[model samples]
Target: MDPVTFSPPLYKQRYQFVIDLVKKYKPKKVVDLGCADCTLLWKLKFQTCIEVLAGVDINRAVITDKMYRLSPLPCEYLQPSERPLTIKLYQGSVAEKDPCTLGFDLASCIELIEHLETPVLEKFSEMVFGYMTPAIVIISTPNAEFNRLLPGLNGFRHKDHKFEWTKEEFQNWAQDVCSSYNYTVEFTGVGKGPPGTEDVGFCTQCGVFTRSYQSEGSLTADSCRDTEHSYKPIYNVVYPNLCDGTILRNTVISEVIYWAESIRKNMVECAQEDETVDNHSYQASSKSVPSVSNISQETCSTEEHVLTDTRGDNEAYKEGNTIFIPLAKLFSFSKVQKLCSSLDHLKAILSETSQVELNSDATAMILSAVEDIEEHAEACWDTSCLELGVALAECEEDWDEELCDS
Candidate 1:
């Protein structure tokens, strides 16, 4: 079957969001979990400097010889010669593959959770988080609230989907998984509408878990929904903060910061070790070679110093200097920054208002932050950055009154 033919409209938007995140991380090797036709892998190959982009899927139909010929766009776009990107397709299940063994820098499971049984979902999470040491993993699934908004009961029913989850359910489940395995959890989405809209029906939630790391739980679903829903739409988009450009920019900045810090720490450690070794060597050699050479007095000493300096310069050439920063760490810093800024903004608004009561001040603060981020994200147009900017702008349209107040 042609995957795109039956796919939802929001798939494009979701794909763009995932691709942006991947680019921000700049993974050297990317593994797409449950990649139906690897359309996302093909698109992401163009956006980031990924050396290896591989897709794993259970459906053999999507990867057959005929399908490769039939679906030329994805393959053509992924061709290294044409685009400076390399992609590999693997037909299998994510649970079966060990990401650590594969040495993937980053991995993604987009819109694949609803199809798995609970046990399978748990296993899948373990494989990605436990076995796969990828610094960053992106997972997205349908929001139950949006599913309810579908035309009828039939809307929630998908032939392949084992189960659909409400926003609360997915959040709760994700929090547990992240907490168990030391991963940070974040929630965001695509499209413009009220709490739920058909065009942006699916809820794109990304669980960015790092190895053996934990963060204090901040906002709960009820609290978040209360704040988010009370704040009326300023434009066509629902939650302006979740816009694509803002997300991409935030992710990119955070990744850079994280990598920079890691590099600095490693350099400091290496320098300390080098100093210790030099001190030990000098102490031991002091006895073998007289502190002051018994040369032809001053003239011999001057000639010996010059030769020592030359030898020192040549010795420096023997040591190689190379910098290495894991791609996942580099990309995640931007995500951390964006998410931190967003949470801070949310906290600032919440602090100004009563927990039981939602006020206009809180709404205004949210709108202001969204606008500020959107303004700053103008330069990033590759992939879905431009479209995301427009979406956030439209969501802000409903906040005109709030903007005026500010």
Candidate 2:
């Protein structure tokens, strides 16, 4: 069978169920036993709460074949979570005991248990619940009762499945594991059956086991003893992150402040132009100069400019050594507003960033206390750093006003 016959695709639904649990549990260390193609690890890596992500499969060739897909994408380089993401893929078996796989907060065995021989299940259970003993374990397998509903599925869902179990049998096995390992178990499933088929439950059955007692002989935090290693490490990746606050202080904060000052300057120029128009003494500058950045003078303000080019003659803002690029301003340009269509998004970034101080309304920002940002900026400024956008400015302002008021 192609395995893509089910609605929403059965594999995808299984992965989504695990992802939902991950978001709720917020596990720090996660491992997937029998992680064949590693599609689950790829999805799990995006969850910020997972500090360490591991995948183990019996076939070295099978796991290594998908390693390239795990490489970080280009955009992930620019923006990463506060916690560094570490992903490791291993070549091993669920039935084997590996010390290196111990102490995971969550362990998964998606559509893998039925593939093991009946006798091997003992070893699999012992290795997972007894030895590695993660705080939580999720095991999913095809529900034999739902097989009659699948269009072309034969004797079993897959040829590799050594044996399939009914819901009662699966639940009995799960209860045995829980009893043996001192873990609590809950049974749930995904993929709805046809209208009158509710009695059999979902197409895929899953069991979630949570540790009820601490494992005996748990390794000390500073233990010098080296535990045994069994799984062969295939690939590892450490993503660039904002944990150190340097990127937030340097690139994000500096760019925001630079744009905020530019907005203030433009607002002042617009007011002056209003005064000049009223007095009938307005004079267009001798030379028409374009802006230093892509955002033209017309785009930054609602009013028109007809006097001396007041924006520092299109000069880049520089202080001492660092030349702050107006990336925020560039993003707000009419040509590129899609990148930053609303200033509220920018405000959210500023509000969440560590070492960044925002006034009660988030109109003003303080960054001097941060290590890499300017120390002199510890004092609050009088300008609203993020009050404008391009075409979406008005909607953004309304949203910001409502959000900030709360």
Top TM-score model: 2
Model 1's alpha-carbon lDDT is: 0.53
**Clash number for model 2?**
0
User: Pairing residues by index, what is the TM-score of model 1?
Assistant: 0.45
Write model 2 residue lDDT over 4-104, tens digit each, in one string. 35678888999999999999999999998888888999898889799898899989888888777887775664454568777887777788776668778
lDDT of candidate 2 at residue 155, scale 0 to 100: 97
Query: Candidate 2 deviates by what RMSD?
Result: 15.0
Instruction: Give the alpha-carbon lDDT of every model.
Output: 0.53, 0.70
Model 1 worst lDDT window (10 residues): 228-237
Q: Which stretches of candidate 1 lie over 4 Å from their true place?
A: 1-8, 65-85, 99-101, 194-206, 210-406
